[model samples]
Target chain A: MKIKTLNLALAASMAWGTAASAQTEIEWWHAFTGRLGELLAAQVEKFNESQSDYRVVASHKGNYSEALNAGIAAFRAGEQPHLLQVFEVGTATMMSATGAVKPVYEVMEESGLEFDPEAYIPAVTGYYTNSDGQMLSFPYNSSTQVLYVNRDKLEEAGIDPDVDLSIWENWDEVLTQLKDAGVTCPYTTSWQSWVHLESFSAYHDVPFATNANGFEGLDTELVFNGDIQVKHIDQLGEWAQEGKFIYNGRRNEAGANFRAGDCALFTESSAGYAGVKAEADFDFDIRHLPYWDAVDAAPQNTIIGGASVWIMEGHTDEEYTAVAAFLNFLSSPEVQAQWHQDTGYLPITNAAGKLTEEQGFYDENPGTEIAGLQMTRNEPTDNSKGLRLGGFDQIRTIIDEELEGVWSGQKSAQVALDSAVERGNQLLRRFEQANR
Target chain B: MEKRVIFKGWMLPALLLMPQIVITAIFFFYPAGQAIWQSMFVPDPFGLKTQFVGLGNFEYLLNDPYYRASFLTTAIFSTLVTVVSMGVALYLAILADRLIKGSGTYRTLLIWPYAVAPAVAGVLWMFMFNTRVGVVSWYLGLLGYDWNHVLNEAEAMGLVVAASSWGRISYNFLFFLAGLQAIPRSVIEAAAIDGAKFWTRFRTIVWPLLSPVTFFLMVVNVVYAFFETFGVIHTITSGGPQQATTILVYKVYSDGFVGQDLGSSAAQSVILLFVVGVLTVIQFKFIERRVHY
Candidate 1:
């Protein structure tokens, strides 16, 4: 009996020995492809090589919407990954998933990791925090909207390549000049609702929806049909009629038109820089997103539009510790600076920005700092802080549909905006009922 | 005279039917039953909380104007797809039937498109008619005719229908060709001997004999248009340019999956199921009357 007991103890120790040698594996499902995806993989590899305690495996599930859907379905099937990268639009949906996700604060605290929520930039962190002012998710790749100017196209049109397009008035004149210069596609935009309405409202210090743009409560109502939004859209409708502004598809599909040198101006995400840099053979510059001169607080601040990493529940405490360590490694100043400089995403921490500046990276890249400066130019107002609403993706679709009506000359801007608000309110009500 | 099979032992027949019943119950009835059950309750995103709201989802959907508009869109979309695909397929099949040589080559070339997925077909069509950088659109622009489906409702609807029908024509052609080849040549010769031209012969004899195949293809095509062509619509137009192409199935998918509104999505599914059921029954009772067989 004594010999048998000793043998069993020896067997248990040997099993643990093999386990200790093999690092813990933490599955991370993200929604980035191309350059961003490669950068993410590199970050994971560096983290893995720097430590022997854990191995972080990063997988590209699909695009933003697909990845979020995969995570939700996986969680329901009791096989969710350790971490999920959810896009900015899905923030509200992720926040309301109660027990399905472990808050970042809780994860860090439980893992006994040294985490300071204040170390992150407020504008980036505020979007992913709870009502109690605790960070819920780790902001990874955040970007704000910016205007991309094809300088070569501008010069070809006989307009100044350094034209000031910071305001709608200046853009209107530039567009008219470009149109008269035989430019068929003078100006086009990607993410019409994002650049034209959502960020536009925030940049002009106007409420996109009530309840602080749905950040305060679930009972938020659609209020984007106010005078400011109507005027801006009305002006765009006139431009559409004049062949100055072209209406592309709902998503970032117009990036192709701009990158191919077929369009002179493009309002797209800051992260679009990578594609433009890679594809365009012409000179291009990044400009601040234009604002309306009629508004009292024009160009207040632009909000972010990118994904954040969330820790999924149903993992061991040991795995949670690994996740914390991995996120910490990702959030380090050197890593964040490299990611920001390479990807054109905003550095999530001020320390990273300072580090990048100290390294003279921004000075070398010229226009690379516009996105961060635009995001932090002024303190964010109630309207400027990022929108947090359920059914936001659907609402954006409705806005796209209604705006298409205006572009096609089927309905006036007022009528289209009014109809969109009515339709969007119904969706919001449905979402509120379900979540409440 | 109608032929009937008589079973001597009930056990043998029951056992034979058992597989089909089990398959249907497992594959169809089980998930459908769950959808119906879920339609009555609204669940939060996490499924952590749910509220029983019997008949509320249905009532809301009925009152919603966009849902009603989508009903009309689906009706128009399905009709166009069915007619366009079947009409083109019948024409091609007749042409192939007339050809003496290279008929096999033509049929094989026509059958190649059916292998492409619906989403892939959509992308192919979208590229041809894309607003910018499209070969066809550029030619059209050169001809002083602009084609922008991104903002044009009619163009958006036309693009999706063309794509959906383009992929489906191959399936319809296969059936129509088989049906056309099965028609006895002696009958056509006899009709020709009766002083009938090609159009007259086709109208009187060919169409009548092809009714059974036509009826089967009609039902199959309608079901395909209702359920399967969502990938085409989703990829090309996304039911967009002001919901002009927002068919019933796409709405159900967008609402349930993208919006995460499980109750509304389930309700839409139940309504779609009822629509397909009623449509099938109506086609049999109404359309099958003209079938001579």
Candidate 2:
């Protein structure tokens, strides 16, 4: 009886060993949870099913910031996965990690895959590419800032559903109208610095920082306290004081109020479409991010906000090949179109946009095309391409503090912006010194 | 007069002390030493290269206004958390002790919150005070109070202190209750027979007897507020509404993990270690003085 049991255990062990060794495993750590995580898992399942030689295993490693930390810690422990998903703000940090990352261009070239850099949207890929015009990471999910309007709330507030919110002057009038109509929170914004400041600078074709928004060199100084930027922030501060604008917690905490149909207008990432569409019972419309008419030819373009997948170092060449194949599968037109349509993230590739258009997916979803159009509206200027500043996340926190000062009525817009610039410059100097 | 059981041979003593020494070296001293070593060097985010900055990181921290502000924030936050939590816990412990019939039931109910994670407790309090949907905020709004912590620094600090204290009250309650129950019944009865009022008995007898427990809990609660309440601050405000609640530990995390400034973060940790050390020393001195009484 003992011999029989031992033989059965040995047979089971042999079977498991063969099954596991039959396919090479690719570990992918991502920040996405909820519906996005489900979609990522589904995509990985399809990839694994399509190719029996390689199995891609995807893991949710907390939020964007936490996932980036996990990757760094894992790399230090020499146990990093084959791929890591990092938010856009960490682009500079990832690029500066010299030997810690394997650029996507190198991965594709080494895998002998027919890779075309032009297949992706310039604006989407531009944010993740190096100065040499080489792609550093796969633009997995990119979102541009856009305005969300509750049409029902607008009608109730005695305002036109089609009221032009394209320019700040019109937006100001609308906000006042809503306030006069007794709306408590007529306007609130998510990602204040991103939508109001970063995208604001880019849309007005103004430099947020010197050195072409930190792309030219690391010795960049914050120039976001520019006249136009100050003018816009000053208006928001005035509105805040007047109770027309509600100050929500930093990030998308205000999205809840807007989705609850309490706030009439929300300036948030276009990706908020997924949540707003699901939760909001009111009829809503997506519009271009409001611009300052004071600038020459207003609304240049809004920069990206979501994350991209970067290939980490210390993975075997075999694993790199697997990662490249997985990336290719992800970027396929059909898959990209489906992902874009499902998640409201802008399609990374022009082919996916065209495919979605040809399939009438955008036609069915009227507001979905706005994000893509907003990103590709014009040839991106040096200022509008994207920010690539080391220690950008820290700078954003500093910006949040100063902006909070304005909202809390503690300081004027100019004072807050000036402080933000001075503090942000110090961090920039520190980052430069550390890296050098 | 101290009880002594000195081992006759050095070999046996070393063997007996081996486990504790190993644990301290591995769990405490080693990582702390690493942090101290790393504090003197700045590494690029990729960890490919590092430069010896000597005391550069510490000097920068001392000069950085935000870092200094965080130190003050930590001081205010820990004090508020320790006092509020211990005060409430002691009050509840006394009430539970007075309830002779179902004291165990009340004790169990009060202790349940300690089982909750600090982050979860933060979320729970956050939900109750959330500007849009929070019951407390909505009620306050109806009363024309306009409870908006997102923009209100005082309210933000209040919310974090409440959340941090709420979780710790359960822990403090357990200790206070144990101390209360450990008191001799005859002594309290004799005080009652002497016509001493409840407040007077508690003040003169129960309070002095509870001092040791109180002192121990103060140290534990201070450390808890300093280190363990990071989750509470992170979840409730992300240390914001203008860094009103950006405590020292949260800054260490934000700078180290989120900002990826390892050298600065390590330096912050080293300074924090020094602060904790000084606090512990002061606490021990106070405890020694109280012990003589």
Candidate 3:
């Protein structure tokens, strides 16, 4: 009996020792937490289970900024992960990383995976593509701004629940209706500088910056202080002063207010769907963002939000091949469709969209298709594509500060915008000089 | 033979200190040296390409209005927070010292704020001061004031400084309390027999004896005020209401990570290191001399 027990113990020890050394771990650093984090973990687990070749390990470094910083620091230490998720604002910075990254298209091609760049939605793919229309990063979770309406709140305010807050021909009509309905918090938005200034410019088919919003080159200049921007901000400021439009604190604190049904209308990213679905007890609908009637081409496609998975350099070829396989797995029609349905992010591939439509997701979940419709309805011009400016996050901060001044009645819209332009231009010049 | 024996003993002690010295050399001294080296040159994002610019980055920073503004703001923020925190902490320590009962409980309760991490501290203060749903805003509304830090410059500064000091005062209090307790009861008794009141007793014996602790706390508070409040400022205001709350460390983070101007950010970091170094040297030279210890 003692000999049998010793034999069993020896067998267990040998099994444990070999199991510890078996898995070839691939580090996937991302900027997701909460519900998104869970979904991401499930995806990693599914991928890990599907294959025995490599184990993909996902770590939440921090928010977008912190994750990017961690990736950069790790890269400098020669310890970068196989895959790093970078937000849209870091596109230009990532592009300028000379040899710190291996382009996704190149990786896919080198790995001999049956890859097609055209398989991705043009608008979604273009943001992370090179000038020649080659994808540089995998579009992991792409979202665009949409108007979220509290149907219950609207009905309570004696406004028609079916009223087309979806298509505001002009700001004048939006203000009139909101005032008539006595909406104390008619409209509030998260990422004001994003939805209002950057995406707003893109949606209006207006230039936000010179040099095709910095896509053409690094020497981009701030032009968001143009007439259209000034007029919109001034109108919003007026609404703010009248209590029709509430300016929540910077960041997404307004998300809670909207989810809690305090606000009648919210301008936020489509990825906010998960939070709204979970938190909102009242009926709500997502709609296309409202546009100004005066613009010749209103509702020109909105720019992408969320983030992309950039493959950092310095990993071995085996790691790259593993990354390519993981990305391809992520981009498969079934996986892409499920990811889009699970998170409010857009389907990156055409097949995923068709799959979603076939699944009756759009029909069952109204307004889920609005983002795709808005993005596809208009062919992207230079102004509508996206901004790729260096120091853009800092520039956004500057815009936020200046716009807050206008919102608080401290500075006029024109003055605030002009100061923002001047200050933002200085940052551009510094960026240009540094990168030169 | 005695000298040789002493030298042999010192050799072992030096050997014992080698690991720490090696770590400091590898981590701290090496990176600091590299930062200084990089500040003189322009390095690419990957840190591969380098071109010697020789003070070009410094010259640019000097000429740049935003950088200058950030520096001035940092100085003002550091000085104000340090002075205010030290004053408040000293007062609290004195009050706690005078209490004959439950002094330990008071001390423990006072130091509790320091136990919270900076990130949580930032979020907690942000929750309290946020305009839309903040409890403080509710109170302000009751008082008939439209209190929104996001739009008001003064309010933004006040909110950041208050949050920073609130988190920082506990450590200062702990130091001050310890210093207060260490004072001999005989001195206070002597002052009492001589008809000295509480204020007079504090002004003479207690104040001089606590000077060492006060000086140490001042240096610590200055450093904390300068570098440690970045998380609070980042969460609360993000240096908003037109860059009113942007201090040095926050600027470094913005310029380095968010802004992606690694060279400029490194340059700013070097300048901060220099500023902190100067302040530290002056504190040691001037204030340390006045310390009773």
Per-model TM against the reference: 0.96, 0.96, 0.90
Clashes of 1: 0
Q: DockQ each candidate and list the results.
A: 0.70, 0.77, 0.49
Q: What TM-score would you give candidate 1 relative to the actual structure?
A: 0.96
Candidate 2 — which pairs collide? none
Query: Model 2: which docking level applies?
Result: medium
In CAPRI terms, where does candidate 1 land? medium
Tens-digit per-residue lDDT, A322-416, candidate 3: 88889988989999999999998999999999999999999998888888887877888898888888777788888888888888888889999
Span of ten consecutive residues with least summed lDDT in model 3 chain A: A166-175
Question: In candidate 3, how many Å is residue A38 off?
Answer: 2.1
Per-candidate RMSD vs. true structure? 4.2, 3.5, 5.4
| Native-interface RMSD of candidate 2 | 1.1
Tens digits of lDDT, candidate 2, A361-404: 87887888999998998999899999999899999999999999
Candidate scoring better on lDDT of 1 and 3: 1
Error of 3 at A80 (Å): 2.7
- When sorted by TM-score, best at the front, the candidate numbers are 1, 2, 3
Q: What is the TM-score of chain A alone in each candidate?
A: 0.94, 0.95, 0.92
